[model samples]
Each structure stands twice: as structure tokens, then as C-alpha cells.
Target: MPTSLCGTWDMISNVNFEGYMRALGISACLRKIALKLKLRKVIEQQGDQYLVKTLSTFKNYTISFKIDQEFGEFTKGLDNRHIKSTVTWQGSKLTCEQTGEKKSRGWAHWVEDDKLHLELYCEGEVCKQVFKRNE
Candidate 1:
């Protein structure tokens, strides 16, 4: 059976998000706000379909897609850019590719020991985040 990612997660730690935002060409004001904002992730998984919502005080982003299916995505609050996104499972890790103007843009998600781990990358900067499962 495929791994299920249906739960709420609270941010525990974030590393290098400011640098990553800079690499993405986000404004300095936005980067400062984003660095301090708390993030919550709510994910719903049904079969091969997934809905992931990322909530923060500064911005909220939601994405819905099926496994291995490519879809057009617009990053509304984050960057206001369009990209073609595809998500696939690599073992227990969920890998996503965002193809657009940016180079090396993608994210990887995995759950280990009740903690949800995320690696968000763009350009040459990488942001690592850890979230604890909410009870």
C-alpha cells in the first residue's frame, strides 16, 4: 500500500528559508515576514489524489494533484508565478518538481518518527523544515 499523508502538522524548525527566498527573488520585506511566520500544513490523501494546504500569516497556498500527473500551478501568495508541477513517490518520500523560469525548483516530503520533513529548493538554495504531527 502507498503511504498515506493525511494529517495536520505544526512547524518545529526551519532552516535557510530566508536564503531560499532570496534565491527565488522574493522581496526583502516579504522574506523577512516569511522567515518569522509560523507555518501549518494540512494534507488530505485519497487513493492517488492529494490536497495539500500550507497556511501562514503572510501567505496561504493550496495545491491539489494526483500522483505522477502533471498540472499547471500558480503560486498565488508566495511568488505569484506559474509552473508545471508533478509529484511522484520515491519509496516513502514524496517528491515534487516545479518546472518554470527558476532553475532547480522542487520540494521533497517525508515522514519519519512522527515528524514531517520537507526540503524546499530553488536555484542553489535549500530550505529544510521539520514539522511535528499535531494531535
Candidate 2:
């Protein structure tokens, strides 16, 4: 088993996020606002269960799930969409697949060199976000 990625992470970089949001049908105004806001991720993991929280000055998104279990998920403050989501471990990476209106929508999270990395993808557009662990 891989080491737990359970901790607070402060965003260091978010690249191609606007295009990824656009691919998800987000409005121009929301995308513009999202670009300026700072984001943080808090992850709590116990065995196969996980609680992931995304927080920012403008909005917050939270989800809880178990590895390899599929559940209904609402994007809520992020995309405002309903999808069946499942997360599984691919080697050391935590990968998620979302089934909804969009095509090829998903994200993967991994830790490298004490940094948390995330890649969010939708409709061929990918957004890469890197976060530094908060000590």
C-alpha cells in the first residue's frame, strides 16, 4: 500500500484551468473569477475511505468516498453537475472517473517529493494543479 496523502495542501500552481473549466461548460464570468482565487485542498484518509475538500475564498467543494466504490456525486459549487463518480488507486495514484454529460471527465491525484499533484481533465482539456504540503 502507498503512504497516505492526508493533510492540508496549499496551491502552488494551477495551469490550463480556464480551458478545463470551459470544457466543463462553465461560464466566462465564473472562470475569470476562479482564475484569481487561491485554492486549497484538505484530504483525510483512513484505510480505503477518503474525505476530500477543496476550499477557496469564493467557494468550497467537499466529497467523501471509498476506494473502488461508485457513488452519486454532485459537483455543487464547482461545476453544478450530477455524476456517478468512482475513485480507485492505480498504483500510488488516486484516480477518479466521473460519468455524466461530459466526455472523458476525471481527475487523478498523486504525491511526489512532498508535493501534491492533481490533473483534472474534461473533453480533451487538462488542468494541472500542484500544491505544497502545509507543515
Candidate 3:
């Protein structure tokens, strides 16, 4: 099994998030606000269920699901889109596949060197972000 990805993480770097937002058709105004906010992630697991929260001063998004099971999700504060999502382990990465209006939209996460790595993708644009454990 891969290292557990459970804890609070503070983002240290983010790249190409604007391009990914553009693919999601986010308003330029919202994108600008999102860009300036420092993001954090809180991951937790219990039994077969998992919860992941993307937090920031501007907005926050949360999702909960189990591996290999499909669930309904509303993007809520982010894009306000409804979609079906499934999460599964792919090698060392925990990947979520979001099926909705956008093509190839999803996110992947893994931990290495005590830092958490995330890749958020929509259409063809990918945003890479790295976070260190909050503690």
C-alpha cells in the first residue's frame, strides 16, 4: 500500500491553475480571486470512506467517497457543476475521475518526501500543486 494521505496540508506551490480554471470555464474575475488565496487541504479516512477538503480564505470545496465506488458531486463553490466521481488507486497516486460536462476533468494526489503532491486537470490543462504537512 502507498503511504497514507491523511492530514492537514498547506500548499507551498501552485502552477498553471489559471489554465485549468479556463478549461473549467471559470469566470476571469473568480479565477483572479482564487489565484491570490493560499490553499489548504484536509484529508481524513474512516473504515471504507474518505473525505477531502480544499480550503482557502476565498472559497472551500469538499468531497467524500470510497475507493472504486461512484458518487454524485456538486462542485459547489468552485465551478457549481454536478458530476459523478470515482476514486481509485493508480500506483502510488490516489486518483479521482470526474465525469461531467467537461472532458478528462479530475485530480490526483500522492505523497513523497513528506510533501503532498496534487495535480488538478480539466480538458487538457493541468495544475500542479505541492503541499507540506501542516504540522
What is the lDDT of every predicted structure here? 0.91, 0.94, 0.95
Candidate number with greatest lDDT:
3
- Once fitted onto the true fold, the runs of candidate 1 whose alpha carbons sit more than 4 angstroms away are none
Q: Whole-model lDDT for model 1 versus the true structure?
A: 0.91
lDDT of 1 by residue, 56-103 (tens): 877789999999999999998788899999999999999999999999
Model 3 has an lDDT value of 0.95
**Per-residue lDDT tens digits of candidate 2, residues 48-67?**
77999999999999999999
CA RMSD (A), model 2: 0.8
- Backbone Cα, N, C clashes tallied per candidate: 0, 0, 0
For model 3, the run of ten residues with the poorest summed lDDT? 54-63
Candidate 3 local lDDT, 1-135, one digit each (tens): 978999999999999999999999999999999999899999999988999999998788889999999999999888999999999999999999999999999999999999999999999999999999998
Q: Which regions of candidate 3 are displaced past 4 Å?
A: none
Q: Which 10-residue span in candidate 2 carries the lowest summed lDDT?
A: 1-10
Q: How good is model 3 by TM-score?
A: 0.98
User: TM-score, each model?
Assistant: 0.96, 0.97, 0.98
Compare candidates 1 and 2 on TM-score and give the better one.
Answer: 2
Q: List the pairs of residues colliding in candidate 2.
A: none
Residue 61 alpha-carbon offset, candidate 2, angstroms:
0.2
Q: Give every collision pair in model 1.
A: none
Give the distance in Å from residue 74's predicted Cα in candidate 1 to where it truly belongs.
0.4
